[model samples]
Target: MFITLVTLLEEVKDILKLHGQMLNTLLKNDSMPIMAIPDGVVFPLANVEDVIAMNEKCSDPEFMSAVVAMVGDIGGSSLEDATRRMMKFLMVPELQRHNELAATFNTHSQSCAIKHRQQDTLEVLDLSYNLLEENPALLGGLEKLSTLILDFNNYNSHVKFPYMPSLTALWLNKNKISNLPIIVEEICSKFPNIRFLSMMNNEAAPSYFNGGSLTQYVDYREYVISQIPSLEVLDDTEVQEKERELARKTYRMQRIREGSRKRKELHR
Candidate 1:
């Protein structure tokens, strides 16, 4: 029993020593560069002071958790403070290599210069639930981005999207989009590879769904499909083969009628 107690006491001492070493490393004011640490390593410390201290010691962090930790709870913070803190982290060179980014609920506008060093490597970006005054040029550099979620923003009819060749899926639900024709024209011209698009709950969508009729919904879907030939999924519904054929026929007939009217005007 005495031997067992001695061994247990030694084990406890060793454990305490190891913990002390870890604490020293975390609390140390040494000038160790952050890039020396392996990519994607999480700092186990809590609080903004420790995080900022570590950030100063490290040249770059794998994730923005430390920067976000500085902001505390996002819900309780003001929009300006949240946006400022998030932008500080986003400007980091190491964080730019990350494929996915979520900056939701921050009131950021087009004036915010959200640029990254490795823009081409980014794939998925979510900027939902923000007060975006206009579509920012931050997306202009992200050529390889495929999935972009910008739901519940301040986008209106005059807003224009940057040309993104690799973009496939886009979510613009609950935005202030009103002019369907102009936006559709811009999308058709700019996003040629876009296959999935959602604009549900926008101003233009409800106008088409007057009285909530299924036929009106179909009409809205068909018109959007006609405008954007590359679209396969629209507003969470898949465009069927029959609908595609019908849309094509409708588009061709409309073009023929417009051509006839133009010719008549020219002759007059």
Candidate 2:
């Protein structure tokens, strides 16, 4: 029992040390492999067999419980914190395999800046609180991205993005949007696949749900529903069939006529 406990402690130490190296290197290399070990980390084993073996043993639920039992939890304190970090650190490799990165903050990198090969791997992204006023110069070939969070940005109606056919959800809560039809048309044009959308706290999406007057909220929802035929949820509410039917009856003809007028003006 004593020897087993000592071996477990040693394994935990090695895992944390290697994980620290990986995370530091991953961050510094911008999610790419490091060509050489960075300074300070002394050259060690040439292969990852040791780390893999250690991870497999440490990840066993029974083994984890045994180690924790030996360590003895001390009332939701440092030991728990360290264990939580270890579990999350171990998951980094698995998360990297799927490339489904979410909220990897400080990448303030525009889509054009990321490597082309890595761009399509991104399916979910959170760019919230970035203070962006307009959509960045997003290049083509991001064919897999489906969810985007732009909450707390400074975008207004003039904001625009490259035509993305695969984007299904967008979060634009607490932005600077006052014009309703203009932004709605932009969304329809850009995210032709948008199904879930939120513009809460923007003047354009005013509703009693966020302390806005209830009177015009219905108008807001109806107009948006009329514009985007693919939208399933607006803000926080699911679009009902009855509401959709009413929206179509209310604004479908008006939208068609307006579209016709725009075409005529452009032609002339």
Candidate 3:
């Protein structure tokens, strides 16, 4: 009886070992489950070959969505090459359903030139830390885009906001902006639907705020909020009811002054 019990225990251990080996093999295989990829894997561009392999194992659309969501930047031998590769990858019909995209730390002008055939589904885009002097024509295609992050870019007075009727949020931190009035005018004209705006750490903002004094900051905030009535947030802070009231009064007075100036000019 003792001998039979020992043999049965040995058989159970062997079975458990075999099961562990099988699981490891499945995990190592290219056909591993999509969820197996760590959530922290933000940059799939760092391992394009692995992404390509995963595409072979999974359906193109599934792999494409996963890769698009994970990729941070498209790195290549050159800016043009990277842009071309990114365009080619994104042009895949299966990848069109992705709604969010990040193409930061790349040549913004070059990437913007690459016509994105799948712009319809894109709603949020991060183009930060790139060399973008002006609003690119590529934005015209992304009609549904609501959130655009252009932080750490090279935008200045020469840049104009593209007419994006659906844009609700914009991030312009750490840029070369020096003309607050021009930017506010552009927002009022081009982005009527904007609800959130961030212009922190910009050359224009600090200079306009007179070296970041609280009084100047409040004045700046009031001016911006007045310009864009739909704005609910400014520089990460929510617009309060009192602030809104002040903004409305300021806006009314500014309009009255402008009207008076225009009337005088017309008479002349």
Candidate 4:
């Protein structure tokens, strides 16, 4: 019995270590090859070999979802150009094998048929941290998209997000936007199902300023909450119950200590 218990503990430790190593491998930057969508669904212009390997590995139907790179701005041109190329690549049927995909950063890929109301199967798309300069016009193409994550893109121009009737989650954070586009209001009015919306840190600092003022930050926060009614999560700002309980406990402790000290002084 003692020997069995010791062996079980060792086995559990080995399993945990194996799980940690697998997680590290999955998150490693060099593990997966980086590629662009217009170039290919799996690989951009440079990493065709990686794309092939990804396709072979991901072809297994057991895996529910797989991530792929959409487009990377090699030229760093206007958002319109980036989106155009992205759309061109998405047209390929081979790329859309998985209904769910976590895309690489800054893929402005659009669907022409969806734009024209021909076909629709796109369910999930995550394009975060691309520093997008324009809102892609192709958002209208995603008829079945339930979750759309377009966070950390700095767009100077007004890009519209319309025609996604099934959208639930939309993430728009860390942009250079000073004004919330009117189209966003229209989206709220049109789509009553939207549950999660985030538009945080859109304020641009003044040319000479070292830090943003409290007033400026609050104003932006208030504006976003007020604008989106269906929003469940706002600006990634959530107060955990644990933190609140801890604060309450700390306050009670301080009060008790103060009261004890006062009583001792009175006795003295």
The best candidate in terms of TM-score: 1
* lDDT of candidate 1 at residue 165, scale 0 to 100: 88
Give the distance in Å from residue 168's predicted Cα in candidate 3 to where it truly belongs.
0.7
Local distance difference test, each candidate: 0.58, 0.61, 0.59, 0.46
Model 4, span 1-268: residue lDDT tens = 1121112222222332334422322332323433323222333212334444545544453320222221231111333333334333433434333232213222322331123223367776644444555556667656788877666566642555565669887766656655554535655765568777665555432111325676665444444444554555545664244433554565567679999999999999
Question: Using lDDT as the measure, what is the rank order of every candidate, best first?
Answer: 2, 3, 1, 4
Worst 10 residues of 4 by lDDT: 1-10
lDDT per residue for candidate 1 within 1-268, as digits (tens), equals 1121112222222333334422333332223322222344343333434434545434444233343333222211333333433333323533322233223222232213133224658787765545665556568778798988877677887777889889999888878887888888878877899999999888677534334467667767778999888888998779898999998898789999999999999999
lDDT of 2 by residue, 2-41 (tens): 1222233334433443345334322231233323432222
Q: Give all candidate RMSDs, comma-separated.
A: 15.6, 14.0, 16.7, 19.0
Models sorted by TM-score, best on top? 1, 3, 2, 4
At residue 266, give the lDDT of candidate 2. 100
Clashes of each: 2, 0, 0, 3
* Greater-lDDT candidate between 1 and 2: 2
* RMSD to native, candidate 3: 16.7
